[model samples]
Structure formats: structure tokens, C-alpha cells
Target: MDLDSQALNMSSRADLVEFLGGLADSFATHPERWQNANLPDFLNAWAAWLEDMDGYFQNRGESVPTSASWQLIAQMLLAARVYE
Candidate 1:
């Protein structure tokens, strides 16, 4: 299976996270099925962790961080890299 092709079909970050979570669950339930697993299965976990972090801040009356800022930062980093 082409992971990139499968990934391209995901319409949103939530979809991607759901797919990764299913994969992780499958591995956990049947380790033998993933004995040859090579690719890291951390993206979904990372997404969940970020969600928890956002929720923690929001529950404390802090504004939830928006991905817009991260997107802008990423764009600036990429622009700087190109100029370098």
C-alpha cells in the first residue's frame, strides 16, 4: 500500500489522525500483524498530545492556540530557508 497515496485521500487533519489511530490500535491489538512495521507511528499520537495541550490551556481560561500562528511560522521558516 502506498502510504503517501493513502495520505493524500485524507481530507483533513482529523481524518489523518483517525487513520493513524486505527493503525496504532491495530498494532496494539495484534503485534504480529505489525512485526515488519518500519515507518514511525507517531503522527496521530502527536496530534492527540497537541489536542490535550490545547484543551488544558483552554480549561484554565487561556486562549486555545490556533494553527494559524503555526502555519505562519512555518511559512516564514520556509521562506527564510529558501533565501538562505
Candidate 2:
């Protein structure tokens, strides 16, 4: 949980998509997490979503330890072809 707030530079949309996909996969594997999902039986999913994102950032050299770091992830996702 040692995130550097000032270092919020996500390189590309592809990275975000990959992160989200991994997050979805993790959520699917953890049924207990689904209890918190807004849907009937799905996990909130955002938790795993965010965790995968943190991992993505870390892999990209950005040590994200807070929710504030998610803005960059959101932006990247918004900029992706799927979102468009």
C-alpha cells in the first residue's frame, strides 16, 4: 500500500482493458465476493477490478496504494476503443 500519488501516468488503453478483464476473471473465481455485488449473486466486482488495476499499475512501474490512483485507470478505460 505504498502508492505515489504524483506518479499517475498510465501509458495506454490496452493496459486498462487487460486489467479490467483480469479483474472480472478474479471476481468470477471468488463466489464469496459476489455476495457484495449490486446484482443478485455477483461480487461488487469493482474491488477485484481495482485490485487488478493496482497490479497493472505496479507492473507498469506505478505503485498505487489508494483509490485516487484509479482515476488514471478510469481515464484509460474511457479512452479505449470499447468505450468509444
Candidate 3:
């Protein structure tokens, strides 16, 4: 509702690309730090994390977004690393 609200932080298309590139760089630079080093396991973990993210928002007294946005997607991907 306000400028300070996280809702205002949506990334533009270019920003999203750059952000994802940064994630790629991070992963490339330090694959050893990741909990899921392979695709299948990471995908499974990512799906599980995204599924539970709504309840996490609810438990924190936040409203769960009915729709997904670029920011939410990025947050979920980041969380998937060790969310379980």
C-alpha cells in the first residue's frame, strides 16, 4: 500500500533477467554451497518449498498472494536451497 511495502519491489523484465543471471553466477561460483547440486533433486525441493511457502506467509501474519510474480518466484528459488 505504501512505497516502503514489499509489493512495490516488483522487478522489471530486464531486472528479472539480471537477477537470474546473478543467481547463475552465484551457483557457478559456489556450487559446493548448494544443498541440491543436481537438477531432479533441486526441482523436487523447489516444488516442495513453493508449495509450503503460502503457509509460511500465513504463520507470519502475512497475506498469501493468490498470484505469482517475478519477485515471489525469485524468493522461492532462493529459499528452496535449504527450506526443507
Residues forming the 10-long window of minimal summed lDDT in candidate 3: 1-10
- Predicted candidate 1 versus true structure: per-residue lDDT over 4-45, tens digit per residue: 565658677677667777777777778776545543455455
Q: TM-score for model 2?
A: 0.33
The TM-score that candidate 1 achieves is: 0.33
Q: Give the alpha carbon lDDT tens digit for every residue of 1-84 in model 2.
A: 111221234445665456556556756777565456545323346557655776787788977766455577566656774763
Instruction: Tell me which of candidates 2 and 3 scores higher on TM-score.
Output: 3
Candidate that beats the other on lDDT, 1 or 3, i.e. the better one: 3
Cα-based RMSD of the predictions, in order?
Answer: 14.7, 9.8, 9.2
The C-alpha TM-scores of every prediction are 0.33, 0.33, 0.62
Ranking by lDDT: 3, 1, 2
Report, for every candidate in turn, its global Cα lDDT versus the true structure: 0.64, 0.56, 0.72
For candidate 1, the lDDT comes to 0.64
